[model samples]
Target chain A: MNRLFKKYEGKLPLKVINDIKEKLPKKISEAKLKKILEEVVMEYNKMLVQPGESVGLVSAESIGEPGTQMTLNTFHFAGVAEMNITMGLPRIIEILDGKKTIETPMTEIYLKKPYSQGKNIKKLALSIKETKLNEIVSEFMVNIAESKIELRVDEKRMESIGVNYPVIQKCIKASFKELALSKKGDSIILKLSEKEKELNQLFKVKEKIKEVYIQGIKGITQVLPIKKGSEFLIITAGTNLKKVLELDFVDKTRTISNNIFEIASVLGIEAARQAIINEVFKVIQNQGLNVDIRHLMLVADTMCATGTIKGVTRYGVVKEKASVLARASFETPIKHIFNASLIGEVDHLNSVVENVMLNQPVPVGTGLPGLVTKVKREPEWLKNKH
Target chain B: MKNINVKKHMLVPEHSKLTKKEIQELLEEYNLSLNELPKIVSTDPAIERFNVKLGDVIKIIRDSPTAGKSIYYRVVING
Candidate 1:
């Protein structure tokens, strides 16, 4: 019963679950589970707010060797900087083609380190450029040219619009270091590293991406950041920017012609202000919004930028911190049970969760002694009385 | 406590030490907070983390090459 936290190491702490359940005031019903987990999430958010403002994902710092004394005063913004792995092009293709199950589905988390923006924006931007929508289309155009002219952008609209799955996959590719790559001819291969495959089995594939033809590129500005306000619709996938331009009211030259972004623009000013956010929304939807949606979007955008989905935290985004032994023997609280079973203390479970909850140091690896009960130090008010 | 100047709130702890009276008045006369005061010792925990003041001001200074200098405020943690 104590052997569940590991497929790799078999540190199963199922006994700890039993110990925690006893401590829990309520039964394990759906509503109760939801409430407790939501508490866990809300607590996580509160720790992130700084004095001035909650730092947003766009971390941009201009000039110097990075953060020179004078530079801290600049518009120092940071984009979501976490790393996780996606199902690589080949694996995604396999998933798309129905060759694999989402056993340990990949999800990501992200948090910004205090000053990494000064360290690597140029590399991050280069990685971002590699995911450019047009560049993806150019590749498709190239592949199609060698085979058929009918497939170019605007030629079929499908070639230019929708999910841009290939680019999304490439974005995932370019953002993170490939821990594993295996090629066996026409089937290029890839395997996610432990860091990349963190939320293994946490995502659900919602929609099978369908390719759409490009209506032609339009200026991004041509489309007002209005939601569902258009009189016409050309996109069978995203809003039809080409069709919208065809409208007498919208002057065509001012809008961007890429169909996916156009549809994103149609989604609203909030969505259009940053095209990446819109895609993130879709990825979370595809995966299922079991956790906080903002966390999902945060994780997804970080992945879009970094290519892996781990819950974001200050030091870095977590990729794959899977404790397989815990999952298998989850009949009861493994940590508590282990401490009880071995060290004779039922406190380990709460201690682990508490450490994780506070974003403080957590017990690791061989250090996790089977089971335990009770908490160590609850923060005390410095002064006892007035 | 009643005489505590509003501009000096960023300074002084629930800070264990009292600032020399002259520095406190000098800070208030300038209408500038402690953050404007140059950083001296950095060993203080409040200075390093919360940027609170014992005799320090987390003043706002805006210095950017492109936008030029603009005034901003900060909880000067160090000096």
Candidate 2:
């Protein structure tokens, strides 16, 4: 046991070391222990990637091969009728492209303590759901004669969303300073200021009133509390990660948004890298496909290595390549070549793509090694003696 | 200045800047030059917390399903 511990002292993690120690027989001979340690070390070393292996190509092919077989569809969140997560091939493309705005941005918000244990989860979910003015209003009637627009509030809807009449009135007044707002019972009346009180102005005011922010978190269109592993968590259709994290009831450590770029900007690039890996893994797993997490991690590392999230496209990571020929080989060869030539850029051809483009042996695998020799002449005295 | 703690993040691997002696030992063990190894920018988020400079090497320890744990070395270069 001491021999095993000494052998793997700093090389292996403490958890792995302890696990091996617990699994081995307490009375094992020194030779047997040594043999076991050797086997474990050999297995670990074999799992490591070789020095000159093209990890980028392997990762791309690993993901791309299975990516073609993925379904092009969105998956409905389990037990939540209103929310659907973007999944499959289209979602993969969206993520790899590093799009700023995805078709459907969502977040899974885990709650802390009491909330996760099913304490007023329904009411909490309702409070978290964003309620726009148009969603809570029953109808909007524009009176041409009075040059005013009247919005009838839905009492039940407003009550359910926990928004009061005064709150709606205040929101409308704060948002639209050009219009005068007055609340009477369930209806709110809007009229343009006297100086600009044209008939056409009322229609514009009516349109603006429809988009007024009434209550709840902005950008989160819907929120549903679903039971997951005996704990209830909220899943939101739209994402507002920063705002959501600010809530006192949220488990900030576990709450995450599907949008990687948002996570990068708000959390940091490290978090963004993790988000990318998780998002990709979730998509692949949802489609019943098996992909090694290492490949996804490699891709994520490449995207976030420069302290920012960049896409694999020409405008992103490809554009940042150091070699001129490497960038030209990606897309629009002429443009990249011309731009490089204009600046007198140099191409070292150190990477695989540039060498492959030039029909040269790539500096990977067998081509990584080179032979060199030095010739020395025999001394005249030694030659004469011979 | 960001409030989010990258070190506490679940996905980020543990990172430490290698000393000069350690870097030399690593190079000798791998039979590689500084440029031959993979590179990471000095501003990379994983190593941002460390007081690393250009040409410094950072050691990253990641949890791997197949290997139990894996160690990787990357040289820090200017962005």
DockQ of each: 0.03, 0.28
Q: What is the iRMSD in Å for candidate 2? A: 4.1
Model 2 misplaced stretches (Cα beyond 4 Å): A1-19, A29-32, A78-82, A357-359, A374-386, B1-62, B69-79
For lDDT, the strongest prediction is 2
lDDT of 2 by residue, A1-386 (tens): 58558777666556667688889876888888777777877886787689899888899999999999999988787776767878899999999998989989988999999989999898888898887899998999998888888999899988887878888888988988777888777898987788767877778778878998877888888888889999999988899987887788988678888899878766656567778988999889988999999899889878876667789899888987999888887899999988888999988988988888889999998899878777789889999997
lDDT of candidate 1 over A119-145, digit per residue (tens): 342322122111233333332211111
State in Å the error of residue A221, model 2: 1.5
CAPRI verdict (incorrect, acceptable, medium, high) for model 1 = incorrect
Clashes within 3 Å, all models in order: 106, 0
Model 1 lDDT per residue over B4-74, tens place: 12122211112223245745665676687664443323333223344444544333322222223222222
True contacts preserved, each candidate? 0.00, 0.15
**lDDT, residue B55, candidate 2:** 77
